[model samples]
Target: MPMQQRMEMWFQAWNSLMQDMERQGARVWPLIIDPPALLDEIEAREKSLGISFPPTIRKILQEGSRQVQINWSLPSRALDPFSLSGDLGWSLDAFEWPYFGVDEECEDDKRYLSFHVGGNGDMLLIDLSTDAEDPPVYSWGHETGEFLLLGKSFTEFVERVTELGCIGAESWNYEALACEDGLDVEGQVAQEWKEWLQAFRTLTLDEAVQDFEKLVVFAKMHGAEDERIQAAFAQYDWEQVLHVWVKHIEQETTSSNLLPWCQLIVKTVGKKAESWVLSLWESEHCERLGSSLRAYVTAVCLPEEEGLQRVIAEMDEVVARKECLLGYAANSHLHHFRAREVILWMEPHVAYPIEGWDDLFAVSRPQWLDLIRWLDGNEAQRQIALSAWGKMLANGESPAGEADWQEIHRLLDVAYEKAILRKEKERVDRIRSALETTMY
Candidate 1:
């Protein structure tokens, strides 16, 4: 059979199975397939990317972008029941052949077309360098920078995924049975709000302002006292809303959840809110609230050189006080800012070792390694660094792989030399003892 015909058959079977499951009270969210991309859009994307997508890929794009949630516990040919639940679907632009360039440090063979990113940052990639009509599917681990072959072709990959039931597990409602009322009031309300907000995307500026007022009224009916919402409703004052959110942020007792709403307001108002968010850095609030504000500003507002300096200063204070610094450093926004400056600021503090290094390492190994290397000098820093490293190694916090092991030993060697230069016999002996057990 033709590959496209086979794909259509598989999709039909998959959709039928999902419908059957839903009818059987499986609480499944049906797959969302986006409209097909235009040929001109595809051509433009190909021109820009400088690579022609394979026939199988083009067929999949023609079929439209698909997002579905699968209930793994239910019968399925495509997924492991034990695998973590999450959404799986190609984005609309994935079909439009958006740029999927390899990272600078990645090997030449690592060049692949990324489509869906798993909830855990694992990527579904098509190996472009393989020169196949339909490139083999591979899973790229963000943490390890490793690829695991999944299937020989896109058709086979879809079949395997459907069999494993992996694509859309997160959309399933496990606790849905418990909500016996047959209606999720909160969810419905939130959904309605989201729909209204989405409508603003297509509305004229005047219409958006009118709808914005209606949204505020609706929010008020729900007992929401957010000043930003109120400010928007009254006179469409976005600057006032920004000011109010900044004030709320500076309050020590403010809930962290409010940060997102503040960001939403800033985003709705556009670049005007950017300056307002940045101005909050100098607010006379407690260090915790100030830090939180800085984090929100850096993450949501906009990237600025001044914002990077503020983050570094915040880290310096955080480190000096032996406070939790990982949250700020690990933020996705900080990566967009001065990543190198952030890493440099974080290096000296690795000796103290904040509480969330393991989580941080999973997100950014390169930055983690840089901090690990900073432990190479100074007797006090070496002692703290070695102790932390030894503990993590002993507890199996570090992955037991050859690459990781070699890196660990390299750092250990540096620490050992530092211990010797400091003439700290006890520390050197301790390091030697740890090394004895660690080295193969």
Candidate 2:
């Protein structure tokens, strides 16, 4: 397909896709910035970079050089429904530099022309080695400084991106475009994407619940991810969603498959969800489920006097446990039920993170780090313990004592060191930059 035709088709789809995001409560609007790029500037960049722009790229600039956008950095045609799109090459000057273009240790000496710059410092580059009319696209990770093929060609990358926008996918959810094994063009990713669009239509509450369940079973059979199914239940009543998840919890020995649902339940507690929560709390069955309920959801489902006590008690138990790997998230994980007020209420009762906390002193895989990689095993109790400490200081309030202040320093220091070793530059920089705020 010609670049002009391909972009025209995508622009039309962009209008519809923005409507989908609006229905989901996005405060965003699309803009058509016509003649987004200047021909002279494009030619200048090509010459300065010592390479010719791909034919597809040159045609796309003529169609819409830079102007289509929901905001300054994102393109209107291929905007992610949930996050900002990478900036298209428009004289950002960041694109002028190449990854390891100077390092002698770098084995791959292929020159790359970065056409799309990611918000997270990653980039989509056109490989200039053995040039074809339209070259292959590769992604450079900001974290590991590694390159991975994104699409066999720029046209394929364009199609895959627009398809994702149409499906209301988030920015980083690019599994369908994975190019390592091979582009799974007609495979499960493509098939499920079609099915998701079909299943995304407006349905009665009962129909949506039933459809969600069917998708769950189907996804498990194919080893699919859970974000699609979670999005389904999140739109409906907590009572209905929590009830279905509880049923699944009772049926399955491992509550691992239902972590997202449990996380939702934790986020959505109210009078409408009271009776079922109480019933589950009283039930002897699903002792595993009991742990989650007893931990934090109790603070919202029950009376303040009773709920806060249980929350404190649960955290106490976890803190005392040997090598505990995740606890105390109630403070940051709030809902509309005045959860923040309740969290502050427990500030006196609940134990704030400290250097002496069991996991902090552990020889390996402390709770702070373990929670970062929680989905690896057990599948159950995959709650984020890091939030309790990482976000505790960021909640727009001064600490009650010096303990939490010092713990903030500890959490930031520990996380930064780990992030550096893990080669996660984004995380390392974020944590390292905040280390000063933690310093007394």
Candidate 3:
């Protein structure tokens, strides 16, 4: 069958499923098919752009745009329907699509045409240069610059969306209708509570407590056993939840389990949890925590300025104690909110033989790169960064493999070239000497 025909079939199936959902009283966005005049407008756009619309794309334009807004209870999939009307240009318009003689073309730009906009500013693009009759669908992240293949074709994409929508529709209880029809509300509530409990079993104690509280209210309304709910709550040691989270933070296991719990606590408890986390920051184990946990806790516990100050103060204390590695670790955490401060703090110590250069490099890669970019125009800062780079190259053990060694070499080469371009001869000579002595 033709790709357009398959897409039409998927559309019919999706429309029918959505109608059934509406009939069941589920809230769904109304599907709007573009009129013939709108289709003409799309054709006009193609003519103006000097590009031919693929058959599948033309069919989609003829069918019009759709917006699927699933209820909060359902997992979100895509953004609400975006159309070609008023400021909306097909997905390509939102991006810096290269035009012949007008803009430099990206290697991947010529191979795909963006067809849909995602909720998070991602674009759903259709591969145009592929040999397949129905080009594969790809998700392009504007922020991350990642191109992920989503589906083989437009038809498959629609089918997947419809499948998710159907699952969401089925998950709806239609509780009002069930009540009107004299169905067992208590039984339904009991089942949902069991599901919630099962989900909570996979979460940390902090997360479980937060979820359990909401479950209690919901259970009470549904006439579930109050004692059972209370017992379930009692099973979790609420008082120790923060301590457990702190332990995870100290051990750096929070990213695997406790970070989400921390996010939930911050969101649900808000500033109420701030004091508790702040107290934990004073603990001896705070230095052991991963940069992520430290940064997140600092972000949540204190305002930006206060957090930056706290990080700087901690760094100063560590430095005064002659714990240079710990000080560097503390400084690494401030890179996101206070990059300039980090640069300043590291300036005096750049040439110092810091023991944890590897740890600092791993944790502060982006910040280091940002600092380097900033240093590109300033001879003084570039020299300081170069000295730091040389020390790191000399003191840090080369990573295990050739690939890793090559990556380090590549970064060094880039920095060396930047120094040459900026006419920082001393920086270039230092980087060159370091590069010559490096071994995997």
Per TM-score, the best of the predicted structures is 2
TM-score of model 1 vs. true structure: 0.34
Better of 1 and 2 by TM-score: 2
Off by over 4 Å in 2: 26-36, 67-95, 105-110, 166-172, 180-183, 197-242, 248-293, 303-305, 312-440
TM-score for model 2?
0.55
Model 1: CA > 4 A from native? 24-27, 63-87, 95-104, 108-110, 167-440
User: Could you give candidate 2's per-residue lDDT for residues 1-440 as a string of tens digits?
Assistant: 66667777877766665665454333444544356477777777677777667766666765654544432222222112223332233332334546654557454544677655555666667776747777776777766666676667767765665564432112243544465732344567666654544333222234434666654433222222235444554566666666765666567554344444444455433445666656655646436565654444555566765665655555566556843433134322222133333433332333324222212212112333243333121212111233323344354322233334354455445554554334333443544455556653
Expressed as tens digits, the lDDT of each residue in 322-423 for candidate 1 is: 775554354433554534455454455543334343233323323345435545555544554444444455554432233344665576676665555453
**Residue pairs with backbone overlap in model 2:** 33-67, 36-66, 256-379
Tens-place lDDT digits, model 3, residues 1-440: 75446646755755664564444233456554333226566666677667766666665555544222232221121111110010111332322333223256677777776654544455656777875666776656555565555456655645553433322111122222123212222455534543442232232333434675554333222222234434454455545444544444355432344444455344334345567667657766465544456676676667767776776676667668886444345444654453345554555544333334323432343244444443452444445455555555566632221234454455556666665444455655765676677643
* Local distance difference test values of all predictions, in order: 0.50, 0.47, 0.47
**TM-score of each predicted structure versus truth:** 0.34, 0.55, 0.36
